[model samples]
Target: MNSIQMDSDPIAVLMQEHHRAAKQLSLLEQAVISINVDGFTRHAFECIAEAIRFFEGEFRQHDKKEEQFLFPLLEKHQPGITREYRNEHRELWSAFNHLLSCVNDVEDGRLRGSSRQELVETATRIVHLLRAHIANENTILFVKAKKLFSTEEYKEFRDNVASVTA
Candidate 1:
């Protein structure tokens, strides 16, 4: 492969997704903070909705790519190192769902008292968890994959990632 192709391989694609997700998480955090303070202005609502949509769609697809295309090879090479990341994916999903629920409650005008608190807390949890999770994968898992995979293996990885559905 040429240098440009090498730079834009599967791992690089995943890293780009990570960067996008981190921005969405930041938007989510700011939206939640705005709602907590100002009771959901139009910009805050839009930001929250946009972030939720990204997570429900692209973020889920990103996770599927890792789980299906990347994790198996890592598991084959290192045995059990992928397990913690798998579990974290599940935890992140749970927290995201909780945040979604909280948003729904707010939309329904049910975000009073404890529900407001729950929304803030859930948003905080998902933001922190996802940020840390992304950082870990970038620094550790993807770095390992880059070092371990041969050129042929990377091509197969890229092909599989392209062919697989979320």
Candidate 2:
């Protein structure tokens, strides 16, 4: 929903969001590396904060668009596919919250020693998980959507996306 236009193709809108998420994940990975080498710094904290903001804000809305509008249609054609994506969504949400908690702890000076290591590990895990999840959606789910939806169906999907995102 960030910069996606209402008139744009819904699949393209989702793909744009995926690209944004990929960038944020990469930033998180870099922040973890920075923390490991130089310990906590403002830059590292900023990276974590940015990622948290994206997860809580734009990313959450994007997921809603998929879950409420996109996924159900896809589910009809591919019964179990939505289940897999939803499970991944839950896992990613949990992981993001955990990482955000760790970031908050670090920001407050409550995190130290092994806790910092744990934070780094958690961030790494999230980055990897999200990248893989995005890949799956881009390659499998989006491809299927393109093939399955009629023009009218795609327009309806777009309208639903606009209604939710607007």
Best by TM-score: 2
Residue pairs in steric clash, candidate 2? Answer: none
lDDT of 1 at 44: 84
What TM-score would you give candidate 1 relative to the actual structure?
A: 0.90
Which ten contiguous residues of candidate 1 have the minimum total lDDT? 1-10
The CA lDDT of each predicted structure is 0.85, 0.87
Q: For residue 42, give model 2's deviation from the true position in Å.
A: 1.2
Q: Judge candidate 1 at residue 3 and give its lDDT.
A: 30
| All candidates: TM-score | 0.90, 0.91
Candidate 1 residue-wise lDDT at 124: 88
Best by lDDT: 2
Candidate 1 residue lDDT tens string, 1-166: 2233653478878888999999998998998889788976889878989999999999899999999989998887789989999999999999889888888888888867788778778888989998999999999999898877767777888888777532
Q: What is the C-alpha RMSD of each candidate to the true structure, in Å?
A: 2.6, 4.1
lDDT of 2 by residue, 17-128 (tens): 9999999998999999999999888999898889889989999999999999999888777787789899999998998888888877876779576888889999999999
